[model samples]
Each structure stands twice: as structure tokens, then as C-alpha cells.
Target: MTIKYPAGGMVSKDVQPVDDDSVELTLRDHPLIRRYGRLAYLVIHGEPVPAGRPRFTRQGHAFDPKRSRDYKKLVSEAAALQYHSELLHGIPLKVDVKVYRHVQSSISKVERAKRLSGKHRPIVKPDASNYLKLIEDALTGIVWEDDNLITDVSCSKYYSDDPRIEVTVTETGAKRPNNLKEPHY
Candidate 1:
């Protein structure tokens, strides 16, 4: 799915396109996260290395502690800057939000089942499709504003107290012509 930002203004930015195929990749092998061995790379270090840096330098080369610290900070800011530019240009990101609640059990079937069946069969687990329905019921809506200047999303799940995750995306900082719209995700 593609979402464009700044739907009305002449200026817009194209942030990272959250793709179905790449979601797992982003969540698992994200370069920034993989580099530091923690998810806090962006949140703690600052910005990501330039897209071209990896091509030039070995991904696992060791650097001086001081140099590593400085470069790490630089990349974090770059990431934040890119996101802001995308917002100003009205760029949108594709995102999927899911909320889950654990189910409570009130039954003791192990002893009873074994006695009734005369053979101890493995326990059959209930499918999660039913839980997915609950999550679907919890989804409310997504909103984007001012041609992507600001995108706000709220849901029924947001109404209660749950640990919510907010993901802010920025454009790649590639400047377009004065009178052109960047490609949509």
C-alpha cells in the first residue's frame, strides 16, 4: 500500500516506503539496528550512516571509539532531518498497527480429558484467527493532514491504556525540481 504526503501543497517529500515484503526485513535486519546490536541505534546514537557509506566501508570494520561515537551521532540527526523534510513536503509513510491482549484461561481439562479418552492425546491449541478478529475490532482509523504536512492516526485501542508505538519516518533528503512532486510509496 502507498500513502502520499502533502496531498494538496505543491511541495511534498517522499519518506521511506513501508512495504509488505520489507516489513520483516526492517524489523529484523535493519542496517542501523544491526550495526550497533540494539534497536536503540536511532533512538540513542542519532542518525544512520549515509546510504552510500556501506558500499565504501566494510560493514564490520572496527573504528576508533571516538570516531565511531561522532559518526554515529551524525547518522541519527540525518535520519531525523530526513523525516522532518518529508513532513514539510507532505510525504506519507505506510504503516501497520496491531494491538494484542492475552487471553485468560479458566478451564482444567488435562486430567478430565485423559480419563475420558483413555489415551493421553496432545493438547490442541486454539487458533489465533479469533484473536485477530479482536484486533481488527480494535482498529479505528488513520488520518493524514495538509497534503502530508501532518499525519495523525487514532484508534479504538488508543482510547485505553496500552503501550503504543509511534514511528516517525523521514524522506531520503533527495531534492526534487522546484515544480515537481516526488514519487509516492
Candidate 2:
């Protein structure tokens, strides 16, 4: 934590000498582990899929073939990237997700559009919420102890020539200085 003061504030330049062991000067209120922050990120290229709709068989077996395949691919991509990043255990996190969908061909029918064309901002399907489900499921065992630990999430969908999904995960309450129990003295 940094403190900023206006000119002529009460901070004094001199420190008066006191009896040894008579006083304690504490700069931080919490352990340095509170400040240790880590960011785990990955970008999956190709068409993104929503959490698959479940299909039940006559034998009462349920499955989501399409979404299962998609999550498999997504998880592999995330695992490859997350292998080098720190795994967050029971820590509240902030998840930022961005989905870029392939531009549809129907926009061509509309004519005489300025710089604010479909490419800059395109209307697409497969709700952002669906993407969240798939992503959260895929990342469960790899990045965190459980999906319930996520305290916050932000996600959006967009149009792009190269379809992809980018996920950025941050440990929200973690502080800096990796060694938590080390004595400052």
C-alpha cells in the first residue's frame, strides 16, 4: 500500500531515537502473501461452443456430444498454458472472458455502412453465459480448487475474422511477496 499526501502534511522527516525494544514500527497490516498476485491466461482459437445441451438415451444415459468435444479442446488448451502458472487454491478470483465469433455472411445485404461496420462490432449468437459455463467446467480441476471459489466474473462476445476465446484469471485478494511466513526482521 502506498500513501500520498498533500504538501505540508503531518509526515515528519526525522525519527526520534527511542529505547531499544520500546517501540514497534509496522508498515503493513497483513502478511505479504496477501499481496502475491498471479494471472493465468489462455486463448483458444476456433469456433467457441456453449455448454452442450444434454441428450438422454433410452437407457437413461445422458450426454452432450458437441459440447463435450468443445470442452475437451478448450481444457487442453488451457492446461497447456496454465502448466507454467500458479494454481489458485480456495482463493477468490476474477475471471475475464472474451469470445470472438466468426462473422456471418448476412451482413453483406446491408449497404453503405461507414467505419462502424460489422467487423468492428458484430451481432452474434451463443449467449455469453453459455460460454461461461463451458469455460468454468473446463478450468475446474486445472486452475482452482473448485468453481465455487470464483468471486467475480466478466465475459463478452464479439465478432472477428479469426474466431477465438480468451480467458484471464486473477486471484483477487492475494497480495505480493511470495513468501508469506518469512519474518521481515
| Clashes (N, CA, C under 3 Å) per candidate | 13, 6
**Ten-residue stretch with the least lDDT total in model 1:** 41-50
Cα RMSD for candidates in order:
22.4, 19.1
Candidate 2 worst ten-residue window by lDDT: 2-11
Model 2 lDDT, full chain set: 0.63
TM-score of each: 0.19, 0.61
Candidate 1, residues 101-146: lDDT per residue as tens digits? 2212343566444433435322233223322222222221222233
Residue 23 in model 2: lDDT? 35
lDDT of each: 0.29, 0.63
TM-score of 2: 0.61
